[model samples]
Target: MRKGILIFTLISFLLLNTPVLAQEPLNNIDLQPFLKLTMNVTLVNTGEYPKFIAVNPTYDFKTFREGDEYLLHNTTDLIQLSKANLILNKRVGFWIYPHEVLKVEFSINIPMDLGELYLQDYADLCYPDYTITWSTKRITYPPSLGVGPLCEVVYPHLINYPILVDLTSFIQVRDPEIVIYSYSGEVEFTITNRGPKTMFAVALPLIPVDAKIYSITPNPDMNYTEYMGKFLPTYLKSQVQNAKFNLTQESVLFEYTDTLLSTMSSQQNLIQNSITTNEDIVDYPIWIVVLGENSSFDIKYKFQWEFTR
Candidate 1:
């Protein structure tokens, strides 16, 4: 009787402590459109044990241009992604119990196109398509249990899954019309967005030869300011021809003595010379103008000529 009771107790303990073989948790992710980019994720645990799941979100872009040959048309330069400011927490980690449904909510900033220098020949060309994916990993041993996994488990097993969500619908950006004018001492850039969607564009100013920039009316984007401030100061200074002036003076005296009358006569003379130099003073202010979608903005650069001969 005693041996049978001990055997029953041991079996009960083993059955209670052993982990049951069950399928991994199911993940359902829904995304809002681009205008209000938000995500609603639902994690369902259908197992008998609690799951400590960590969901990580990431994004990638596909563009027509690739490699160093098409560096200017890189996907990163064309579009930008960031987290949106919201009251809900952005962190995606929690414990889901057996047969429990856990809902997670987060928001992301709308993808912003930095705008192109020139409109592409085709609307479909030179644009980028973005995809957002969530990688969910189910930790074998919960960190709260103060225990670590007995062995290293490779990912994509029964406990790991990856969910891909296509976001191409929201990223369909239309091209805008850009016009630039170079005047004698001024540069004008105009952008018009005729598409239904808002457009963001970058305009590179064409500065006239030998033009000395005074100021830019209606200040440009902060990116232009930061680029010029950090990188272009020394380069622009080299283009300017600094005015130079030099002055010189010299004096000469002659003395003559007459022996007949023992009279000495002295003559003094002074001469002054002045020199001036001039060159073509030319300065080119690099500009990266940003234009908003469905709107028109004029970026005017006022400058004057500094010529000396």
Candidate 2:
């Protein structure tokens, strides 16, 4: 009777410790989101036998049925997995035996940068069929471009460039005066032109790497009337209705011409000749033509660039 009671207690303990299989089918499961491409998953098998879970590959990722530490230190295992051309689509199971839980971790070597990645596991035990979805969040950014010191990240993310221009002459323009800002896939250049010249035609020589030049429109808040009044007053004569400009792959050119007028008269004994051009002229990527003899203007140009990959 004592032996029988001890056996009952043992069975009760086993029942309490082991994970119970759900009566209904487990169709879906969501895993924790990770920042990096690699993640570790713990799969529990409460079924009667060993089952296979097929992982769907994303971004041409390869799978190896090995743990992180073992894959690194164990050269034999690494070579074996490397040579093993496991059919990605048909690659079945990181085996979990009955009443057992297995922890499997894997890494993906992606060809290009990824913002967020979604991974899945299709596990069908026939008895309890299920699918598990895992996602990675863009919480952190690794230096995927390169590990070198000079490596730059130029994705269409939130970025700002502080611009300062103080030039007595064009030769003193050693740095750029325009600041490029990209937010929510829209690119904008916040430009402030200040110096001793009436800007006629402005050009941006260098742009962000891998960014294509496209048509840009002035922001509505920007005072176009005031802009033309200070710099190209000649454009007003032509009845400038709207802001117009052109761009090239390498440079952004302002589609406006410089206007100059001169009047001279030679009569009998007295002769008078006058040529009007501002002396306070400085050349910059942003061009300006002086409107008056003592003309000096500070203009701000804010425009947006629309582009794709």
Q: What is the C-alpha lDDT of each candidate?
A: 0.28, 0.27
TM-score, per-candidate, Cα-based: 0.22, 0.20
Candidate number achieving the greatest TM-score relative to the actual structure: 1
Clashing pairs in 2: 198-288, 198-289, 199-287, 199-288, 199-289, 200-287, 200-288
How far is 36's C-alpha from truth in model 1 (Å)?
Answer: 38
Candidate 1: lDDT over CA atoms? 0.28
**Candidate 1: stretches off by over 4 Å:** 1-184, 199-201, 223-294
Model 2: number of clashes?
7
Please write out the lDDT profile of model 1 over residues 65-124, one tens digit for every residue.
122111111232242322221112553234446776544343322221112111222122
Model 1: ten consecutive residues of lowest lDDT = 155-164
